[model samples]
Target: MDSGGTPEQVLMGGSMLIGTVGAYLVLGAYLVQLQHYCLAGAEGKRKNRLTLYILVGVVTVCETLRVCFITFAAWRVLVLGIGQPVLRQSPAKTAPSLHILGSFIALFIQGFFAWRIWTHKFNKILGAIAVLIGLLTTTQLIVGVLTGVQLGRIGAIAEQAAVTAGRNGVFNQFINNNQNPGGLTPFAISVGILTSTVFVCDVLITIGMFSIFHVYRKRSMAPRAKSALRVLSINTLENGLITSLCAALTLILYYARVHPWIHMAS
Candidate 1:
């Protein structure tokens, strides 16, 4: 190899470097947000204040662990295993587990939103929708954790045996391993659900926010109040829009018969 190394090495190395930097940047931003939240404290005498605090704490722990995992992966790929071809073929344990951790993070955050929606006043239809969306997010979280356990199993249970016996399994309905590369294993199906579930949940949250705020906007007489509602509605969508779009794109790519590894970009 030349002094620059092969093309694949350069690409992989550059990706690892950029990912590590981005992960730290995100961690820093999250810290700032957490600090701000603590300073602000509880907003009102809301009944779910305790639940909200617990959710925030869980999310903070998951975010920290996620960054630690990424740092460890960067260390493995760029420092410990630098220039080794095995890096190309062997997956890092931290890498796969990151998705599971991410699912936890998403689950907690959405749970917060769901709690908000439930606490806020809403019509029956919107309330029902929010409840259903919340249930879906919970189900997805369960599936994600189960899939992680399935992958990390340490017994004599063969993959084929477990999978074959899993026709009625909750997530197995999505896994159709009839063929080779195209066939969706439990892991692939779980990932696909994760992406789609994220997109669906975000969209529903945004819509619910809009619906809740629209009622207030319609009843308000003051122009300033209406304007504030307008801004808040836009902000609500903005908060979750990017996340939804990214999840949607990942889902598209995963189902498009493209390289399945593309989801790791999300």
Candidate 2:
């Protein structure tokens, strides 16, 4: 399992988990605050607050799913041992698909919120970037699922061969040859590309967030409104930063060939 890799790797993985958890918790709290503020406000602001609630709900669900996927991947790695066939169809392949789906949901929610804020230019720019990233991520997920299905079929054939041939036939050769190949599959390449795209998307989101915060600061809203926006901005920035750090760690592990379990779980 490369447990002996540099201490940095261990710390990085632990920190990634902590950061993701913390970000989600803060986001949840911010949503609750929004709900309270919305209830206290006049009828005119209630509609906007309801929209924010829906957007926050979507983000919460997406992030929760993402954490669940990561946790499952880690659990599989621990149980199966590194490089073992954790899935007949390969969970490594399936994980990216979930990630892509979650990313798209998050993008949609964020775009909706940006639009509500009436930052038209920032909304357009962020929307475009989010759409591009979401498309690439979804493409990668589809590719991974297809590759995993093919590998599963091949594994099934090999297993049947072993049973019929008594372990000393072409089935052994097939199993040996298909032992993931270190980095030869389209799935692996797609994962790499998706990881890189995530980094770029994170950068753009950060910029958009900062721009939004600047606009919020210049407004002459009530103190409560100002405080709410500040809280929202802080939570959003933390979430974006944590996501980017995790993506970067996964990207580094992929290229270093340190084994997929360093990023995946089983």
Candidate 3:
């Protein structure tokens, strides 16, 4: 590969692209379904349909933003300077910040939807868990941005020290041992934690969705309401699973630690 990636590295990169695209397709389909439901004008269900549309629309935007960042990173890695990591530069470096911001926006939307659903007869514990997850996601967003900025500052300090020390200082030692062209830094540990938190939130949301489904199956909600809940439950479950898988894949890629493939590409 032009990026000095091995064939296997190329394959893994390709897989990530395909998987991300597939996720966008699923999200897009659900958004369309939500719009249809919103516009169906089913008498008393207008509010519910509108709420669902809003929730789906926010999630769709988040997913779209994520895809854009991923595409930019991929392009940086594959087509730009062969040995330079794509994420080391200005716009590429901003991608994660954008993702974190988008996640916070999505978290707010998810929380609002969860709150609306909490008045029903479903498991209160599940709803509480979902709400807590949303809160945690918001925290992660804030922490992620702080950590990224801190890491960037550290990189700048290291670069300056490398210049002045002529290769014999603490900062130079840190740079030699810790710095990567990809801009991976110790602060990225926080990002890993944030990603894990997102996965946990997705799992909690899925649990809440299933709890609602179980309650609906046994209870006496209106026929149309029950049908709408079922659609939401199914879509939520699918989205949660996909989100969790993506988080796991990202962590794996981030922490693989050795750039055997990065070097091969270079």
- Say which candidate scores most in TM-score: 1
- TM-scores, all models, native as reference: 0.70, 0.54, 0.63
lDDT of 3 at 116: 53
> What would the per-residue lDDT of candidate 1 be over residues 167-191, giving only the tens digit for each residue?
2222212222232222325556777
Candidate 3 runs further than 4 Å off? 3-44, 48-66, 83-93, 121-124, 151-185, 221-235, 252-266
Better of 1 and 3 by lDDT: 1
| Decoy 2 TM-score against native | 0.54
TM-score-best of 1 and 3 = 1
lDDT of each: 0.64, 0.52, 0.55
Q: Which ten residues in a row have the lowest lDDT in candidate 1?
A: 168-177
Off by over 4 Å in 2: 1-77, 80-119, 122-184, 221-228
> Which candidate gets the maximum lDDT versus the true structure?
1
User: Which residue pairs clash in candidate 1?
Assistant: none
* Number of backbone collisions per candidate: 0, 5, 4
Please list the residue runs of candidate 1 whose C-alpha ends up more than 4 Å from where it truly belongs after superposition: 1-50, 150-186, 221-228, 255-259, 262-266
